[model samples]
Target: MRLIKRLLPAFSMAVASAAYPVEWSGNLAVEVRTFPSTAQWPEQKDNGLSLSFQPELRHRWNDGDQAFTFIPFVRVDSMDEERTHADIRELKYLHVADGWEVRAGIDKVFWGVTESQHLVDIVNQTDLIENIDGEDKLGQPMVRVTRVLEDGAIDLFLLPWFRERTFPGAEGRLRTPLVVDTDQARYESDAEQKHLDYALRWNQTIGAVDAALSWFDGTARDPELLPGTKGSESILIPYYPQLRQAGLEFQYTGEAWLWKLEAVHRDTEQEDYRAAVGGFEYTFVGIHDTPLDLGVLSEYHYDSRRLAANSPLQDDLFIGTRLTFNDTQSSEVLAGGIFDLDHAGKSFRVEASRRIGQSYKLSLEGQLFSDIASHDPLAAFAADDFIRIELTRYF
Candidate 1:
């Protein structure tokens, strides 16, 4: 309790700082979602509403060579208690010198190319409580150094602490039968959460080809699910193990087509496996004399741990389409589906967004699970299809 009280004020610098004045900007939003039907699980509802606020604060000096950033975010939900949360998206200090840079504190980094999934992105842990698809990430504290080269940049990272993945509460939909106890989970390392991690990445762009090579060692950000029996009940526990991983991400941007690839090989205490996803996108502009653009995407996924996987995408095909209105409001839409080649399963999603008036924006997204077999892990959530709408105000 004392440690937390001490750290809270450090992160609350926007209110306490008098020496370095802070400037703030961000968004406030409200969302409504409908599930249409009851979930297969209990304590779940059909409709829900949530409100979120995020404020970004920054202080800079030294002619922009140095700066400090802080982004505090929070959300409240009417139905799902698990969805209500708060987080610091960024709390970092950055310094740039000639051909070199240094960053220390909490930050977020992203890597990968495909639209459906990100295989080579492992710098930050996923904030699963915010979204199930692992698209949102928690801030990770670390020290990073970058060296600029003639044709590429090399980055080095020293991570001293680890963050646990958030899970949905018992009342949350799309959760497992037994709630996962993240605090009571086990670790294979003797250092437990004290284990330090390290990583290196080299990125370069040669003509139209942009690519990167990365390697990571130490504690794994992902945890394995383990089931245990209580007195008269059962529970699921997460187990994290030390690991080493090597990854590659590349994309070729052309006039009308883009090719993307991501591959990773992981060596863990319990398993050694590899996974890859590759795809391409082609766009047609000014279709049929209109100001509309259409894009088609196709991708394939493969895993060495096939059949032992919990996802339906172990060996699957993904096809999607993108639509751009090219209007004043800058409206765009995307529709996609993934099909399991070996099994009878499919998943579909649609997302669209547009700016309203001058300061408001509206977005809609939905997902559907269909044709799932009993053997598929997602079969239980077949009735969990839902659509969500959000309206945001920016100042």
Candidate 2:
């Protein structure tokens, strides 16, 4: 079984490349991050650099009824060894029929409706070393079947393997006071990483509203950080508990206005809680007769656990603005702030990007933390404000 599992990926790639003409795309990026504040930990650095590459290859046959896709990613970081890693972002085979489709292999899936937080996206484990917003995810090994309906779709997934979430090492910034010992992870399930997880989702569109209901039975992607000792040094041990979650997503699109909501109820052996994020975005197009659009967004996040919640978003509010320049270069910018209602902690962020030329792009991002409560999760980052720049070349 182990031998076959090891060779399956290679064998699938060989077959795909031989049977069809491969289509190639993706990008290579160089990133630099700068911190203005002094390092809180002696092992941390004030500046960092990294290079990342992701190439996508696809093969399709039978007039698009059958296909194969492969996406491999690698990153080399100068500051943190844990951040320097490689992953298969996607490697999947897909087949489509009259009313249904089937896919198998490693893939990434997203399910959420709110902009501030995604409470319902649970299929893929988070790649925290790549980013803090949970926008990046590791590919998951799954076999999924989807039934297409006239106005809706139903998807069923069987996940055979589990991917642990990545955490920053001792040298990485925005880390906990104690470094996470990823090597000593503990799981509630006796089967551990081999535990079989499954999920089901149904989505439908009615008028201007789109809705989805989903349920997942599996190991929780967000592990509990427990304090432990590692050879006379303090460390945080990751503990994965079994979880059953029910999720709800809703979005209503109107003329220049979008309303979104995402909610989840999660049950575990130690704790059970309900969490939700709801928000709206209103856009003003052609403010002064130019091809510019401005969108105002506001969202509220709530967790039943409140102060006891493991998440930092409990009882918080997010307000942001998105500006899009409808030009050839596709310039865009987003600025936002999340305010903790209970603790008086706030974090502000700004992100902007534009195409430099036909094959290159430039992006800038910044974050600021202020007035963080001592008990707030973000207190550790109070002195870790930084700016990031990225240049990418697309091939």
Candidate 3:
């Protein structure tokens, strides 16, 4: 797979090698997180902290009417036992013309309307509560081609794949009926896996409003079995089966107000699970002469799945607002709740963030789980309370 991925960029470049002037730019970002013991979740009694830093670099050259660009990035997490350990998050080369473009590399792809949804987030940091052993993997390698029409664009990609293999931990043993596997499993071959992604987007202006529509299909693998699960032989777990998604967004700029709305749909198939998600987000901005700007955002998400005879539907709603001061400092508040429409379980979350300076920001997030619903499985491991704090700096 490595050889194939490397050959693709060379081949594409060879097809159109026009000399171009090169330009370079890059940015660095660091994030630190710390958690304190809270009585809300007894299982999370230990205090922990982690730090991560990522640097990005890019070069672009324009020759005549064509352009070539390359971007490569690396990330290091201080929590890693090997202080210098790193992961290649992005390494892509691109060729562009008036209406055609091609790219190849390990890159990040995004396909959703919400910042926190599983369907739309790419280049993500694993949730602190979800990291099995705090292992961070590299981005997927792929080749993509895009065509820019007069008012719209279409793209297709070929992806290289990898899988996660995990051991059964205590939590897995008590919840899942599957037997435990102690030996670590290996990928059949980094060279033979087949993965692909395709996307299309269209944008147009209607009167005073701008609108966009997008579609996506991509592949992803599941994380290793949950800690403490009883699973011995590692089997392929498809996080999403030929995932399909579509999004529509509209924006209206007004003299004293701005309005935006976005909607998305995602469908997935994995093992014995078939799920679909529909989500929407709306934002309202009140423009004033004062230095402060006031805005509100509301979103709704629904996840429907066929797990077992006794499973319940998963649905959630999120409402939030933002207050910006002096154009440089801001505060945001968000509330989200998940409930089983057919059963009796529910979960709620409250999160807040504040920007300290042009380069620094801080955030606190917390979640609560209660009311046992259906026995659909995944919920068994849900904790009563989960909390985390984050500080980030951009350079």
Candidate 4:
């Protein structure tokens, strides 16, 4: 409530600006999931059901130099209380003038281009309860400035408040043995949640490569899990620490082929390490005289610290394929898996999606975790394999 109250002034300023006319659009979706395997824990049930609503509003005026946008999202779940939540995905004011752009309010920023995982993308917190994959992110409160030049672009970010990552509740599947108590989490900095973080990125395209060099000095997004007790029940206490990170991202483009590299080095009081994910993809266009295209992808991920590892892909290899069917519905199917070379752990995913009729869409996804080593944290949820389906109707 305090945070909402503090940020209301920004919202009011955007609303009071008469420089623009408003345009709005929204969508309502119903999604369901089934757990093919038995219950991973006693607190969770067998299946999950949910409904979501998302609406987007935009206003642009002042000769298109100023703009405002609001995207609000909510999901109601029958199986998990924690998953049934709402978010102000994007509510910001943007202005552009003289090769300069500024954005203020809650927004999402993506920095990396790899398919397997994001290494240098740390602006927004992960919405882990939304999906097993770490793709979904929580909007962050920030004020950003970008300078556009002929050679390249430089972006500066001022993060006022930090948003913690979300986790599943007790009655949710795909959770760890030691449940996480987000409310009891601790921060290493004296300023706590109000710590202001800063980041800078200079991006440019040279020849066939689009590359960026970034540096971040602030609180680390990845929290260190610590052991605790919740009224005799063991739990994990997430601890957020302060750190500095430098990242390099590059993508080389060619005819029907792409090479991507995302690498980062970080320094903290406790540890200093470097990690990288490098991969390439080659596509077969118009396969067999058909309109469909098949893309083959392979990536290798390496981390410096590997003992008692929490990351499933600490020292792993990933291989995947994407099949795109050139049709009116815009359908696509993807199959991917990651292999942990050192720990003999592996995880596979199969996903497909297609549009239905004119205003509806359907999606199916399945995940399997296999041969998880005891030293790895993923061994706890190895038995939790399930297939999920979702249908969305756009307005």
Give the clashing pairs for model 4.
none
Query: lDDT, candidate 3, residue 335?
Result: 67
lDDT of 3 at 330: 70
Sort all candidates by lDDT, best to worst.
2, 4, 1, 3
* TM-score of every prediction relative to native: 0.92, 0.95, 0.62, 0.93
lDDT of 3: 0.49
For model 3 the local lDDT of residue 95 reads 80
Whole-model Cα lDDT per candidate? 0.87, 0.95, 0.49, 0.90
The candidate that wins on lDDT is 2
TM-score of candidate 1 against the unseen true structure: 0.92
Per-residue lDDT of model 2, residues 1-395, tens digit only: 99999999999998877877789999999999998999889999888999999999988999899999999999999989999999999999999999999999999999988888889999999999998889999999999999998899999999999999999999999889899999999999999999999999999999999999999999999999999999999999999999999999999999999999999999999999999999999999998999999999999999999999989999999999999998899999999999999899999999999998899999999999999988998888888899999999999
Q: In model 1, which regions exceed 4 Å deviation?
A: 1-21, 229-232
Number of clashing residue pairs, candidate 4? 0
Task: Give the worst 10-residue stretch by lDDT in candidate 2.
Answer: 13-22
Point out the worst 10-residue segment of candidate 3 by lDDT: 166-175
Candidate 2 Cα RMSD (Å): 4.8
Each candidate structure's count of clashing pairs: 0, 0, 9, 0
Candidate closer to the true structure by lDDT (higher is better), 3 or 4:
4
Per-residue lDDT tens digits for candidate 4, residues 1-395, read 99999999988878766445577788888888777777768888668889999999988888879889899999999988999999999999999999999999999999987999899998999989889788888989999999997878999999999998888888888888778999888999989889999999999999899999999999888899899988888999999999899999999999999999999998988999888999999999999999999999999998887764456677899999999999999999999999988888899999999999998999999999899877776877777788888998887
The candidate maximizing TM-score is 2
Q: How far is candidate 1 from the true structure (C-alpha RMSD, Å)?
A: 5.1
